[model samples]
Target: MKIDDNFYMKLAIDEAWKFQLLTYPNPAVGCVVVKAGKLLAIEAHKEAGLSHAEVNALKTAFLTQEPNSLLKVLEKSSEIHDFLIKNHNGFFEDCEIYTTLEPCNHHGKTPSCAKLLSILKPKRLIIGLIDTNKIASGGIKTLESENIDVTTKVLEKECENLLLPFKSWQNKTSIFFKMAQTLNGSIDGQISSQRAKLYVHTLRDKIDLLMIGGNSVRVDKPILDTRYVKGREPDVFIYSKNKAFSQAIPLFKVPNRKVIISDDLFKLLDYKFVMVEGVYTLLDILKDKLDFVVLIISPKIRNGVNSVNELNIDFEILHENYLGDEKIVFLKRRA
Candidate 1:
């Protein structure tokens, strides 16, 4: 079956969607290689610290090739750069490489992927979305300068969705925090309501970690699993000065979960990768030199209880509504 340019580009988008599974706080990207009129390889960025989409796709394409074969073919071998160059062989010689987003040109944490592509001598490059970061934005220009044919603006909307997080991160210099709440605006009520439990499960699937105070764990007894969402589970982060949670807590059963006990309780728990979650706990973490993002899930209030205030963050009541007997109020942090 002959694959048209549109078909290959769509395949690239599908492959890139896999990055959403593992690229928390990072933009998801997918790549596809069509060599000698055949779909040679396809893959997405598996996780934050793993090899990128380009590297994974190339590795899959060059599986039976020689050691450093990519370096020999492309004349470069700096991890990410070499992966693109080596994989460009006969496949890309007179063909196109479709990527969900523009190739990266910056050298942050690695060399420029664009520079490597130029050396590999691919006949044409098709981009779904452009890079928003200034440092990495001109990949097309870099390729064009080397006389490589480059086409873009295909599947622009899909590309935009994949690159949205990266653009947001580049602009804010922080991870984009997303939270979903009930129509009444509560995550969970005073008691562990079913609706709230389902919301917690949703949050667990979206974030890299599930963070809460020791009090919440003791009160809610959450399992912190993503079984309800059918996606990867986030690591559990408990904000506690000591081991206030019982050994029977469901978080303990999860392999990646960590109990962030302070100096007062560090000796109490023998778990690895511990960090403080609250202001008091953060002080202890700074003292121990540990770092992590704190994710707080504030559910709706049933009566007059304020979850934001408990965290010491000042928020203004935006609106209020009722769901059955439960009272839901929209609160925005006071700037």
Candidate 2:
């Protein structure tokens, strides 16, 4: 069976979304290795300062074909690239690689992925979006210089949508508001699935700071730490006029976490990547400043207080998908 480039590239896009926001200062990317139309590996860039998606996928493909090889246990990108270049023995010459983003040409914390692919001489390179970063943008040219068959912009729009957060945060302080609600629009209680909660925790792990209404802090007494994902605790900014609250709030007790209580919203500008969690009242206050809005709508609907407040702001849907019975949407204000 011949491989569908769009199908595999869409799969790669979906894979990359899993690690979105988790790869701070780096773009989330995914890759697939196919040998004679059979998939050898599907991998993604999991974190910053680690291997790119192409390198991880290539390493996984190598180990899948040669399980006992020392490459199986290697984690570093440079080491993996070296092992593959030294031991590949033309294993990937018959394989095609699909990646959501063009492989990087410049070396930073990791080795150059384009250089590795050039040396390996894969049958073809199918990429979604060309890297826009000046330092990393020459991968396509590098691959072509080696006479490798290259296809660009497969599912380009979806790939570009995946990359918006990375590009936005790089240029300015990117802020997004997130809320979990039921089908009836009730934002109260635990409505999201456990998996959805985990997704929020993972996002909390990556952000520099988290902003929430003072009302939420007092009522829910939320721990607000990344306990579910065991990620670094982000600073919390409570948007409240009354600084006097019970000292027993769980967030205040998180070790090494900076908890700030203030009425000023501009304090958000001090951080690069920030998350705001609230309903209509908070959204109304932040409507003009937010870059994105993440809404999680759970399946079950019941009579309760609705999440929406008296707010009028139009949004353009950027991406929408399911997270285990919950519908997650990423929206941006319509320009």
Candidate 3:
């Protein structure tokens, strides 16, 4: 009973921050499965081309030790590595997965979670971040050529701050604005915290494209949803040049929503996880089409004036945490 491994790799980096920024262009990653130390399953990668938190925590530890398997082939499925190589039964011999990244060794749309963890032969394999992409890099050298026992920078800086927007969308589509404020830097009066607006409605339910700031859709007629999370809603983008809107703006009567009023932030490169909220003149007009910024603050001290403390902007925070009274942080931009 000795294994700790940073308490299950910090619970697989806190279950990959509940799909941080909502797995755009995929890269949220998470997984857990354990053995003597017990856990069994944890899971993450809940979207974008599907299964990959080590095959949904190795298909929930092979249907939790095959409890009569066939749970609808792991429900909302993608033919997971041929039903986990036809239902992994070797009860993962002394199991111990952890993952946050680095298990994909190619063969798209499912299959090759490092070649199905070298055919379910787990004994050890920690990882946090490594797939430097060549279509999911070597997958920890094919699980050390099936000798299994792998491990790479566990919890590596919270899995590289949850793959900073899938490594800023690996060459293109990035954005990320976010904002919140207060403690004497008023980003509006609501100063946040229904758990920081339910973590911005769970990053607007793993975003697809959000945008907003053209006087925040004509003075906050906002309903840019994900209604505190349950998923599906992001396809808004009101960038603005006002084509006369106001059918009483509940994000324009959300019904199979797709809003897009545009003044074109180059139509946000077609899309892949954009966020962008508002103020500071929409972050100095998209501030070179940002890539990250979150901020937040909120503790209380409302001396308002649309604060980011009268911006000058440079960014570089990288990470900081908190949720209740708020303080978050996250920035980026310094090179």
Candidate 4:
């Protein structure tokens, strides 16, 4: 069946949600397959190095057909494309493939997904999104050459959501940072207990990763978990140059949290998934080669040292909220 723009939009939004699955250390990817007016399969890239969205969805569909069948699916499945070799029907005779991003065309760690799609020759290719990278881009162009029906732009906003990270990574940029502060521009005062815990929890839930310096961790000893939020939890990344924290620390007790130690401190800790958080130990990450977005929750009241100034980088105010005498200022690094 021919897929409509509305269908594409739904696919796009679903794809965006998939990208969110990879928090902190992973990239999100989501996919869905529909055939004969029934949702055949749905899957998302749950972890790094696992099969991608397309592969996972296809596998699920095949498994549902034969619960105990385990025929080398991806490799053998390539033959299904023969059905589309001619307009008459080789594969995808009446099937529809819907994905959040463009099908991959390159043969990287795995075979080219684009090539596999070409073989399946689905009745129609509905792309909710397009790949933005120079190398992996242009799956639509490749498929069009073979005369298979294709449609796009159904859920552009949703598709764009899934592509946000790749676009940011390819552009060598980060998301605009935001923060809340008091009327006087203070996140805290003489005592660290100034800002409301509810506001801090809100900030933690929206971010894919939460970052802080050794000083922040030492001073606040934050729990850094997102139990209060409705969504998945983000990974907590602590930047430290020395062995100031230990496994006995409360943060380390969390199941999936990671602490990035500097080379100077690597010998002191033996932990998996641990790496350097920023380019310099004491320097702010905004000043380094790593361009991931950061959101700082601070007070506008400058009664204490300014965290932005202490990092030694220029930042712009993105948002502001006032609570009585306190002012919350959201700031972002200049591109």
Cα displacement (angstroms), candidate 4, residue 153, comes to 2.0
Please write out the lDDT profile of model 1 over residues 131-222, one tens digit for every residue.
Answer: 77677678888999999988888888767755654554444322222232333334444444455445445545655544456776787676
C-alpha RMSD for every candidate = 11.0, 2.1, 16.1, 9.8
Q: How does residue 294 of candidate 3 score in lDDT?
A: 85
- Using TM-score as the measure, the top candidate is 2
Tens digit of per-residue lDDT, candidate 4, span 1-335: 55564664465345435334243233455667676666777776554455566666666655555555443343333442232232223424566777767787776554556776776677777776677677777788878887778887656565665555445444332333333334343545432233444445554554555555677677666666656654445565565657568566566676665555443323322322221222223344434433333233333446644444546566554333443344444333456
- Badly placed stretches (over 4 Å) of model 3 are 1-6, 9-11, 14-19, 30-95, 100-106, 109-111, 124-177, 188-210, 216-236, 239-272, 279-295, 298-302, 305-335
Could you tell me how far off, in angstroms, the CA of residue 154 lies in candidate 3 after the best superposition?
A: 16
lDDT of 2 by residue, 255-328 (tens): 98998899997788889999998888899998988878889989887777785567778887877878887888
- Name the runs in model 4 displaced over 4 angstroms: 1-12, 15-27, 71-91, 171-210, 213-215, 221-335
What C-alpha lDDT, on a 0 to 100 scale, does residue 133 get in candidate 4?
A: 71
Better model by lDDT: candidate 1 vs candidate 2: 2
* Cα RMSD of predicted structure 4: 9.8
User: Model 4, poorest ten-residue lDDT window?
Assistant: 271-280
Looking at model 2, the pairs that clash are: none
Q: Give Cα distance to truth, residue 310, candidate 2, Å.
A: 2.5
- The CA root-mean-square deviation of candidate 2, after full C-alpha superposition on the true structure, stands at 2.1
Q: Give candidate 1's total backbone clashes.
A: 5
The model with the greatest lDDT is 2
